[model samples]
Target: MIALLNNLKTYLPFSLLDNKAFKRIEESAQIAYYPENTVLIEENEIPSTFFLIIKGIVESKDGEELIDIYHNDDVFGGIELIKNQPSAYQYKVNEELICYEIPKEVFLELCQKNSEFKNYFFSSIVERMDMLKERKESAKMADMMLTRVDDSILHSACIVDHTMPIIDAITKMENESAVALLVKNESGYGIVTDADLREYILHHEEKNLTIISQIQTYPIISVTEGELLFNVLLLMTGRSIKHLPVLNAEEEVIGLLELIDLLSHFANQSHIIHVQIEKATDLQSVIDASKRIDTMIKTLHLKGVKSRYIARLVSEMHKKMYAKLFELIFPHEWHDRCTLILLGSEGRGEQILKTDQDNGLIFEEGFEPKDQVEITLKFTETLDAIGFPRCKGNVMVINPKWAKSTTKYKEDIRRWITSPGNDDLMDMAIFFDTFAVAGKISIFKDLRDFLMEQIKQHKAFLPHFARSIESFESPLGLFSRFVSSDKGHKDEIDIKKGALFALIHGVRALALEHGIHKTNTTERIKALNDIGYMSKEDAGDLLETLEVINTLRLHSQLEKLEKEKEIDNYICLSTLSKLERDTLKEALKTVEEFKKVVSYHFHLSMVG
Candidate 1:
C-alpha cells in the first residue's frame, strides 16, 4: 500500500493530494487482473466499482461501436459513478490487464473528502491525464534582453532608389540621424550601414563609392517585427553587423533597428516608462510615452514576466495616461463631477496588448453639462491617437450610450437584471467588470453594490448568464485531439473561441456568484480557491492554464501583426513549436474540463 501510494503520488489529484487523503485510497484499494480480450463490464450495466489500470490496454465499446482505447495509468468507472448514471460502455481487456479495483463507497468517500480529486474524476476521462509541474518563476535579469523587434524602438529606415549615389545615402544618414539606408531593388531591398561605408572607405578609392548599390549588402539578414530582441542581438553580435533592417509581414524593409538604441532602451529601462508617464503634461508627450508600451509588453512577456503582473502594470500606465488626458481636456472641477471607468478585460486588469477602448464615463447624478459632450469626445479621440484603438462597438465615452450619469447607469443595470434582453444581459456582464481609473472612484463602487443587490434579488439570472460558456465548444474533441474548423480559417482555429472564451466567462460568472471583489481573472481564481469554491490544486492548474493561454494567444497575435495579416482571435497553429502545440492541446483539454464543471454548477445542462 505504501508503494502504491508513492506511485499514485506521481499522477495528478493523487500527486496534489494530502498524505492522509492518499492513505485512505491506498487502504481501501484491491489488486485485480484480467486476461487479453476479456469482457470486464457489460454495456448499460449499473456499475458500483472502479479500476485504475496498472498495465496493458483496455477497450470501451458501445453496442459493438468502439468508443476509445485506454492504456497504462488510465482509470475507468469513476465518471459514471460520479454522475450516478449506469455504465454507458462495455469495458474489456485489449491486452492482459492488471489493475486496482476500488468499491463505489470508497470512491464516494474520497470525492467527499477532497474536491480537487472529485473534480479530476468528475470531468471526462480525457481530463484525467497530464502531470502538474510547479510553475512559479519570475526574476528580472541584469539587462532587459527581452523585447519584440518592432516594439524595440525601430528607427524608420532612410529609403532611396537603387540609382542613388553612395554620397546621397551618407548625406541622408547624417541628416536624419539614421544608422542605415535601404536601397530599393528588383529582387528586394539592399542595405548599406555606416560600418559598410567605413569598410568601403578604407579599402576602395573615392570613385568606387559612386552608386549606393555598389556598396550595398545584398540578400540582407533581417529580423521580423515581433521576433525577440535577443535573437536580433545574437544575430548582430555573431555576424559582426551593426545595422539590421527590420521587415514587416510582407517582407518589406520598413525600418532600421540599431544596436545602440536597443542597448539604451534596456539601460535604466525599469524607471524609463514610468518616469515618462509622470512627466507628460501634454498630448504629444503622452503619445511619445504611450508608444513604448507594446515593446515593454513584448519584452516582459518574452522574459517570462507573469501575464497578471504585466496586466496590472499596463492598467496602471493606462490609468495614468487617461487621467492625464482627462485633466488636459476638461476643467479641474469637471473631474469632481465624473469618473472615467474601464469595462471588459481592462476593467478586470487582465488586458495585455492595447485592445480597443472598452471604457465609459460615470457622472454625478444630474451633472450633465452642455460642454461635457465636447470634452469627453476629445478625451476618447486623444486615447485613439495614443494607440488605444476606438471600440468598433462604440463602447467608448464618445458614444452617448456609455457616457451617462450614475443614477441613469444604475437605472439601466436594474432593468437589465430585472428583465434583461440579450444585449442588456451582455451589458450587465461588461459592467460587472467595471473599474474606476480616474475621478470619484466611489461612484464606481456604488454602482457595483447596486448591481450585486439586484443580483441577490434576482438569483435566477446567473444560469442564463453562464449559458454563453456553451456558446462555442472548446477546440478539442472528446478523444483529446485538435479539432479545427471546416468553415473559414479552416487550417487555423479561433484559439480565443476554443480555449479562452469558456474559461474566461465561466470564471467571470463564478466570481460574480461569490461576490469576489477582485476582477482580475488570476486573482479571482485565487480568491475562489481561498474561499474553498475550488481546491488548491485545481486553482493552481487553472491559473497556470490561464497564463499559458494568454501567452500563447499573444504570441499568435504578434505573428499575425508581423505578417500584416488581419489580426483577429484566429491562431495559425502551423507556426507553433512542438512543445507549444502540446501545451496548447493540454490547455484546451483543461478548458473542456472547466466547461463541464461550470455546466453542472450552473445547471446549464437544464438551463433551456
Candidate 2:
C-alpha cells in the first residue's frame, strides 16, 4: 500500500507532500485493478474515494457516449471530493484498469498539511469554477459580433464600352443607381464613376466634349469573383474609393463592388480600419490607421458589438500591422527565409490593445549569415519603430539568444525547463504558447511539436508555472471592491494587471497542462472543458469574463489612441457603459473565483 501510494504520488500533487504526509496517504489509499469495460464510478454518485489511475485506461462518459478516456497517470475525482459534491460525469474502464482509491478525508488531511499539494489541489478546483463563469460570458459576446457579407443582393449593371459618351454613362448611373461602371480596356478594365465624372467636371472644365474613356480612372480597384463583399468594403475604405470592379482572372468584369453592397456586412469602421492597417507602409501610417481603430471601438462600445468581436478585430488589426511593419523592413526575400511567431495574447488573437511583446523568431535551418547578428538587431529596431514595445525580459528574436534553428531551439528548450530559472522558465512559458504568423508553416509545426514533447517530459513544469498564475491578484479587493491605485496612471487601477492578466495567465497554465494551444480565451476554455479540465458551466462563465475584459480594454485603448497616448492595457470603468460596467463587475467576480481555483491547485493558502 505504501509503494502504491508512492506511485500515485507522481500524479497526485506530489510536490506538496513530505515523508509523513506520503505515509498517511499510503495508508488511506485502496489499490484496485479491474478488466476493460467495467464501470469504476457512475455520474452523480458520491465518489467514495478519489481515483488515481496507476495504469491502463479510465473513460469518462456522458450517457452512453465516451467523452474522455484517461491513460496511465491521469487524475480525476479529486475535484468532486474536494468540493464535497456528487460526480458530474460517469467513470468506467475501457481497458484493464489499475487505480489507487484514496478517501476524501485522507486527501483533505494531506491538503491541509502540505502547502504545495494543497495549493495544487485547490487551485485546480477554483480554476474550474472560474472557467464555468467565463464560458457563459463569451458565448453571449460571440453572438453579438457575428458578421456576414451575404446580406446584400448583387444587381447586374449595364456593361458598356469605354467609347460610350459621358451622357450615356450618366444615364446608366441614374437608371441603375449604380455609382460606377466597369469598362473593358485594352490592358484590363477601366473604372468610371460619379467621382470620376465630378473630377472631370471640376478639373477638365470641358467635360461636355471629352470622351468618358479620357476621364475614366484606369486600372480599377477590383476583387476576384466570389470574394466576400466585406473584404471589398475594406479595400474601398482603405483606398478611399467609392466603387470597385469585381473581376475574374481572365480580365472579364464579373460584378461591381460597392459601398452600398457591403453596408450591412459589418460595423463600417471596424471593416474599414482592418483595410487601413493592411495598406499602411510605415509607423506614421499605422498611427493614422489606429485613429480609425479607435473610432471603431468607441462605436462598438456605444452600439454594443459584443466584446469578443471587438477583441477579434483588435487582434486582427494588430497582426496585420505587425506583418505590414515586417514587410516594410524586410521585403519578400528576407521575410521568406524566416517565420515570425507570435506567442501570448497576440498569438491567441485576443489582444485588445498594445501590451508587452511576446514574440520570437524561427529561421530556416542552414540559413547562417555573414552578418546574422547585425541583421537581427536591425529587424528588432524596425519592430520597435512600428510600436511593438520590446519585451521587457528580452524575449524578442533580436536577442540572438532566442533566435535559433529548429534543432538548436529544441535543445535549448529542454535545457531551460529541466534546469529552470525565473527568466528561463518565464521564457519557456511564453515561447511554448507560440503560433506562427508568417513564413514557412512547416517550420512552425516542427518547432511546436518539439516544444510539446519537452512539455510532456517535464509535466512538473506546469504546476510550478501555474503557481505564478495566482501571484497577481484579481481586480476585486476587500468587500468585493476593485483595487484602486494611481501608480503609472492617475486615479485608476491597471485593469490589465489587476484583472485580465490573472485570468489569461491562469488559463494559459491550464492550457499547457492539457496540451491545448489555441490562444483565444474562449477557445482555450472550451478546449479545456472538452477534456474535463473545466466543467461545462465553468467554461461558459470564463468565456463571458474574457469577453468583458477584452471589450473594456478595446474601448480604453481606442480612447487612449484618440488622445495621442500610446496604447496600453488600462481601463477606467467610469468611462464604460452601464451595461459594460455591470459585465465588468460580474467578470471581476468571476476572476476571483478563477484565482481561488489556481491557488487551490498550487496548494497556496487562501482566505475565501
Q: By lDDT, who's the top model here?
A: 1
The TM-score leader among the candidates is: 1
Q: What are the lDDT scores of the predictions, listed in order?
A: 0.76, 0.67
**TM-score for each of the candidates:** 0.59, 0.55
TM match of model 1 to true structure? 0.59
Worst 10-residue lDDT window for candidate 1 reads 129-138
lDDT of 1 by residue, 1-608 (tens): 56865787655555657888777777888888799989888888767787887777788988777766666666788888888887889998999988888889988888888887788765442233222312111223423555566543655678888888777768877887666788888888888876678877886685465788878888788888888877778788888877788888998876777766555465424344665567667787778778777767766655656667778788887777777777777778868888888898888887777768898988889786668677878888788787777788888887878888888898898888777788887887788888888888888888889888888888898998888888887776655556787488765888777878788889989988888878778888999999999999999888878877887777677566557665577776655533455577778878889989999999998876
Show model 2 residue runs off by greater than 4 Å.
1-266, 270-292, 322-328, 331-336, 370-390, 485-491, 573-585, 602-608
What is the per-residue lDDT of model 2 for residues 1-608, given as tens digits with 9 covering 90 to 100?
66656554433355346788777766677778899889877888878787777777677878966556565566677767777888878998888988877787897777667666655555543343343334333434454354333212233455668788777877877776665777766677787777777787787765454566877777776677666555666678888876666656685666655574356334536555565566555656665565445445555555556768776777777777667666765546657677778876667776555566767777788876456677667767665654567877777767776777777887778877687777766777677667687666678887777777788998766666776666666666653445666576653567777788788888887787777868677788889999988899998888877876766676577667768887777777444422344456678888888988977876655322
Backbone clashes for every candidate come to 1, 42
Prediction RMSDs, each to the true structure: 14.8, 21.2
Model 2 global lDDT (CA atoms, 0 to 1) = 0.67
